[model samples]
Target chain A: MRSFVERHTFWAIVILLAAVLFLWMIFAVWPEWLIDTLGRKKTFVNTLLNGVTLGGLYFLVASGFTLIFGLMRNVNLAHGSMYLLGAYIGYEVADRTGSWFFGLAIAFIAVAISGILLQYLVFRRMAGDDLRQTLVTIGISIIAADAMLAIWTGTTYQFSPPDWLFGAADLPIISVIRSSGDAVYIKYPIYRLAVLLVAVAVGVALWVFLNRTRIGMMIRAGVNDRDMLAASGVNVQMVFVLVFAIGAGLAGFAGVIGGTALSVAPGEDIRYLLASLVVVIVGGLGSITGAAIGALIIGLAEQFGLAYFPTYGVVLTFLIMVVVLAVRPQGLMGGR
Target chain B: MNSSRLFSGSFSLRELHPATIVTVVFLIAYPSFASNFFILQIGAYSLILGTIALSLMMLAGYGGMVSLAQLTVAGLAAYLMAILGDNSMGVMGLGWPWWLTVIVSVLGAALFSTFIGAVSVRTEGIYTIMITLAVAVAFFYFVRQNYVLFNGFTGFAGVEPPTLFGVYWRDPVPFYYLTLTVAAGFFFAVYYCARSTFGLGLQAIRDNPRRMRALGFNITLHRIVAYFFAGVIAGFAGVLLVWFNGRVSPGTIGVDVAIDILVIAVVGGMRHPIGPFIGAIAFVLLENFAIDLIDRERFNMVIGTAFLLVVLFSPDGLLGLWNRFRDRFRFRGNALLGAERVNKDDPASTGSLEKS
Candidate 1:
């Protein structure tokens, strides 16, 4: 970290100044001119929070996608299907058993098992053939999507979080100063904050697992050279199965969480799939840190675009992707 | 002598195979016997879709780049035609002449495709698919959201083909012939280009980009040019598609339709130019008749299963399966004919398989 700052002093100074300005914006009462130009401080803070939380959700979906692609070189076009299926399964279980946490566990396990079946039955046979594998996944997604529609129909279903997570929580930051000279604190949803916390925990855990653990080391090595990893007496296929299961499980877990935050419907699969694809593309393929940064940028761009330009919101995300492709085709964190 | 042969090769009827003559005759005479529904929906629709899929096949099969944005390119042309020409929506219809609108639309789509290609060509292999798919989805969302220009969700309707030479072109018979002519023109264009220097160079680059680069070829330029050629074909098909449907909507260029184009190209057999048409005909037939076998909503399931089976069993699709069968039959025939005959057919069969 120190070396990064030292080597790129100009960039470091720019980042530091930006961070300080952001901190000031968050803490200080906004001037009348600022509020006139940028709207209420409440909306600005809420948009910022929403974007961060949305980024957390995107990170959950894309990290798994990047992991599988990093290790196995499989694009898994059916991943969006897995997410929708997970949400559907979670909704059903939660509705039936009345335990949202149980539903989450069940969704993860169910989707992970399906991932194993996919790896074993479909991907295993055509291993190392990227195009064919991608095509097969597309076929699988089409079938799965239709089959799901047959079963679930077109209705949107939203999950009910626990009573404790149902309402908003007040934060320390002041949104406005009332005529009485009293500051009014900002209120945000508890569930979204929890989701953000969980995402951070999962990300740190993933970093530790990949960087410190032996199996994680093996997975990293496999990503670099599968043949060499296998030849070195490691069970490479076993490692692949493990990675696929975890990657798929994260998607399933995120689906339940996302379904709660948003809603589950027929077209949500395509939405999340697009999200993961764009995230990975901007962040760089096969990099966890890249996915996180990519997701945050996309999420913020989307929320702010919606708040500011409403009509051309989608163009902002697309412009970011095009710029990234033009300037850094390998991605922000992706290795060449 | 070689140049003369090359010139005559594309035009000579005597040099054409017997099957080609029969097919052309059948197509020219199709409108007389076929019903209006069959002519417009099955025949003309298939031809337009096949032409669009052919653009994808040209890029994927020959260039070794599988892009999911071909339909998006076609969609842009459709939207351009609707916006620039006449439309009932009264949004941005400039009431331009049909010929000018078509020329502009085609050029617009080609330039858009070139831009997409330039951005995508920075990466290699599987990245192409992801990048193109994202671009396709982005276009879908953009058109659906921007109301001032694109008309948002409702889109443009009552988009009619111009009447020319004292005939209403949108009528079933004329439309069928128009589409057939265009499809056949592109079909043979792709066929001829496959044997031309540019196409052969593309195939060589697909096989070994490093070696092609070592040989002083401009790899990126070759690919971008391929994209421009494909865009023209897709752009023409897009114009025809809007005229056929009499409308252009965000739904017309949805992500599902994009994938369907890929499915058609893959299912038909990407090895040759004829593959997309064969795939499109089969797709249109199944789409029109799948209700007889199963629920209309479950057609995706059936096609998806068929796609899975094709990918699993024969990656080169129906053409590969047919070629294998013929090779086996030819081997048996050669066993009885002569060992020298077997040797002559060997390289041809292997060469065809290696093209993809």
Candidate 2:
């Protein structure tokens, strides 16, 4: 325990806590109280839940981005297209099969195959050339987007669960609050719970794969030093393709889940692509833990910003990124 | 050692004579060939995009930073002009004249770019690219949502072109000249800057930042200044874009178009000033006619394939190909200086485009 506490990170965290306490005592207490006294509303609990739920979506997207970027140094600008495709596929499947579960499965499989093909055919050919790879992927993204627009038209597609899972749950804690003159609303969406569960499941599986499996070891090795892994006779090319496919599949899966939660529109690709970038930027590139943490922070910031200050929601996320970048160019998790 | 060996590295093998003369003649004669429509609309569009590509070239080709937000700055400028001018349909509009709006918008864009630069310049390579992308995305959403100023999804329209010397300036010939003159002016300015001390500093930073920092140059400041300079050019191009479209729409300045500019710079050859023109020509022609020839759905496929082919076969871009062919014939006299040992693989020298 002593040895663990002596770790550099532990000591720094302790120092950080001390600073936070000092700041709270010096700056926050009196002003916060005064504002509370002056008829300002505080939503500490509401914002927390909002951030966590929204963060699940971010996690779903950025997780895939991190994995692909980890194995292949190539930046797949077309990741967003995959997500959008997944949503469209899921939407169609749901419409045909009338089973949301089957729709999710079909979307995931379809996206995985397409992603693998993209990796093997296009991305594989453009390895070791970052500029060319970026340009090509960007071109592919534009094509994909145009094709989607052409096929889907410029309409926003939405999805909702069956009657059994239609509405929110009113727990005793929330129902009990209604006794007061002022009514407090506390209805939790089950879809959010499903997303939260999927994020956890994916997280655990990813952790196990990277830590316990031989292929996972290779991926970890590849991220750290591809040249060394190649020198060690590992098939670096195969790893890149597998990593890309898996990452893309994750995004597709997330898209299916996210589509049910959020509307899958024509321009959602660009928005989610930017979200992925923000995740990778704040969370160190290729770090799953970083991606998770970054997604949570950004997601929550976005949700609360929307709820509290609708006009400045986007700007708030941008500010967070800019501030984080100003302080740490490497990110919250430093890049290798 | 041969006398030329010591002087060879110092003096460029090809002199700057024919290329310069040709460029000057082309600039002078371009407007002559422009019929009313070609002169005013197409010509102006080409020049505006070319100028934007010039600023992008300075960053991508010279500074080695691929920025996707350059168009966002242009969009912001356009939005600012609409929001600040008297003729604007926007809420909270200052209703200022076109002149004041232009100046203010340009300044706003410069400030935004500088802020982006301040954060992005701290990192190198792809990190800088992603950082700028985040900034662009954020600004895009901000403008898309806030209805009072940006008009939400519906952007400002009816931005009339400037009138000077009693001319409405919307006519093809006058607008053509306006864009051509500005493009020419910016072209020379960038060329001169590239030839100046600042240009050398930028090149040094691009080639080796650690060494430049070791040598006591303020690398961040140089990068930020480059971004500022680029933003100013983009801002001007934005003003022109509104004039050309007769309106500004969020759809027009989307991420796709931003990426398109980067594509143009790379396709034309990030190495040379003339590369953007070559790229712009190809792009404009492709955009105008490709949909008719192939399935409109597959138009991007053609562009993607073209970008991939260029990058794989010729990193120097189309202009680089022209230079190589020109060099093959121009240096035929001396066996040592000629085709057998033709060193056309160097990207920097390709952009330099040495003349004989």
| Highest-scoring model, TM-score | 1
Q: DockQ (C-alpha) of model 1?
A: 0.70
Q: Could you give candidate 2's per-residue lDDT for residues B243-315 as a string of tens digits?
A: 7877676776777788778778878987767788778778887877898899876776677677767766666
**Each prediction's DockQ?**
0.70, 0.47
lDDT for each residue of candidate 1 in B82-188, tens digit (9 for 90 to 100): 99999999799999999999999999999999999999988888889999999999999999999999999999998999989999999999999999999999999
**TM-scores, each model vs. reference:** 0.96, 0.87
lDDT of 2: 0.78
Candidate 1 — what's its lDDT?
A: 0.91
User: What total of clashing residue pairs does each candidate reach?
Assistant: 0, 4
Q: After superposition, how far is residue B101 of candidate 1 from its true place, in Å?
A: 0.9
List of clashing residue pairs for candidate 2 = B14-B355, B15-B355, B40-B172, B86-B95
